[model samples]
Target: MDKETAKNIRESLKADCSNCFGLCCTALNIVASSDFAINKNAGTPCPNLNDEFRCKIHQNLREKGFKGCTVFDCLGAGQKVSQNIFNGQNWRENPEIAEKMFSVFPVMEQLYEMIAFISEALTYEVSFSLHDNLNQQLEKLQNLTDMDADSLLSIDLVMCRFPIKELLLETSQYIRSELSSKVFAIKKGKECSGADWIGKNFSGKDLRTTDLRGAYLIATDLRNTDLRGVDFIGADLRDANLSGANLSTSLFLTQMQINSAKGNEKTILPSHLQRPYHWI
Candidate 1:
């Protein structure tokens, strides 16, 4: 794929809150805990949101106990809902549509996430064989994104997610299969998924092609490791050290995972994901 297409794909998925109506802060609920500073129920506007549809504490969110906001990304779904679905109409101006708007937001969020995954798969050279399939799915979802609020709410998310997930898994395997043999080999016959590995030290390990799905890796030391093609879906990486690690090729690594983890300047990340601000 050309560099420009790849750049456009990434830009389309990145969150653009300025064009949004602060849907995340209003449509979703937040609890008073480590993640959020205060409690808020669904459909209620966050007190921190200002008249300009901007977070008042945007700069000091983590410091103010609203760390959840820093890691959350709607993947550009907010603007699509605000501009395309409702034509710039917000709940504040017309409170009657608040519930419908909130319901449609989550559906669009999941749809956009699938788009992000498929878009990422298209960028991989090893996944070239699946480019046609990914492109078809991308176009379909892009069309769905342009639909009105009623149509978006009617989508069968279960049916839509299953096929996309299968495609993603297959694409991940294709990429992992092509990795060089010189890389560290994952342990054979070891329980790859749902393993409790919290606080374990895996520093500088060769973890290529590892099936680490649903694994509890909280506070694990993964510094400078070769993590190419490792399936990180459902892995808990809270407080994990990923300094100097090569994660550009990791599979299913989401922004939530990166946001919850610890990383340094030496950590190599995928093009679509950004480093967490809390990391020094």
Candidate 2:
């Protein structure tokens, strides 16, 4: 019902985008920001992309004037649905396949977005009971996504609209229920007592059972702190500072979870978490 609990659930439901294809980058139209020149389309590869499927100019994207690119998140659809599902099939070459693939593209994208909303909704304790129900829905959605191309294309778009709308309504209800709650602001300065900080400033803070739901830790400095059982629901951790946080047994942190958090050279993270090339 409160903010803390709602935060954790949302973190999990955010799409596991690493298992996705780079669809949005290759399929949609994106104009260069102040950091770079030249506009591109969804199916067109950005000049920065290399043979490795990574941005060649990632490091200089900002300095080179492509600041907008840095903030873009495809919700993991780039790899999941694009490369994985389509198997590197680009609509540009085969105009015949373009229509179906393009149609399916937005469906999966919408599904991914809905999953994110539901993930955020799950963070609210009020939605705890709804977890099973939502989980079932998620499973159903995943199954739908896994269907063959023919079946996927045949799916009713309206079906997704209802499910997504319903999940949003429930999440909104949960958030509204906690309107009177106070949010915790994890900072870079002195440590807050009873707070968990694994390998971070609060490295010794006893945040073992702390509720860190929906906390906006955007680019905050974190290193060498205890994260035994911390909940990281709905935390907009984009570009946050995680230098030495020990997240061995962290709660609710999935592949997508780690990807969303900020990490850098000095960041001591779990072995499995690959630091985004942009960070290095």
Candidate 3:
């Protein structure tokens, strides 16, 4: 596919609540804990879900103990199941299919997540060497998404995600290698994975192309840092300050990570991600 076509596919895979039927609010259950306000069953619709399929407390989710809702992104699976799988039928109209719909929703979401990330990888110039292979896999996964609900439910996500994860890791390594050419007297060589750095100051540090996987960075300061190519897949960023940080090209950074961290208008983000509502 051309660059523009790939870009469009990436954009299309994003969460568009206007086109969705609040599937996440109904299909998934939540416990009364730090993440949510109350306990809810899998098939039961959330009380905050309005009749119009909109979240009543969407704007005030953080204040209402539903911070989890603000961080969640279905990656376009909600509308896919609501429209494509069931022909725009909802659980309220057909309660019989609710259980099956809920089951299929997660599977489809996983597929779309892969679609989104793989498509994004294709946009990077470093991924050109794997373009043919990536395109072939992307097309195969897209075709799988079009299968019937029964077929979708039978798919083993573990087996499917294995090879895709390898591709992404390879892509990240390639980009990191390219970035290593730029010289800078910065703290660029460090293995801080699984290390406790909570409430520590790292402002103006050069962490480019660093391996920070599975690191504990909760409530840490990272303001105005050069974070390009940093591996933040499993980093704990809760309450971490990222103001003016250059994460626009960061590796493996997700919406969940961004939501957990604190940033101002100056903090740069990836092209496909939206700024968190709580961010100043």
Judge candidate 1 at residue 107 and give its lDDT.
90
Give the Cα error of residue 20 in candidate 2, in Å: 8.7
Off by over 4 Å in 1: 1-7, 126-129, 180-191
lDDT-based ranking, best first?
3, 1, 2
lDDT for every model?
A: 0.82, 0.54, 0.83
Candidate 1 pairs with clashing backbones: none
- The residue-level lDDT of candidate 3 at 92 comes to 75
| Candidate 2 per-residue lDDT over residues 105-139, each given as its tens digit | 77676666556555545544554657776666766
Best by TM-score: 3
| Overall local distance difference test of candidate 2 | 0.54
Tens digits of per-residue lDDT for model 3 on 23-132? 89988979998779899998788999998889898889999999888878787888898889988887877788889998899899999888877887787665555887
Ranking of predictions according to TM-score? 3, 1, 2
For candidate 3, the lDDT comes to 0.83
Against the true structure, what is each candidate's TM-score? 0.89, 0.52, 0.90
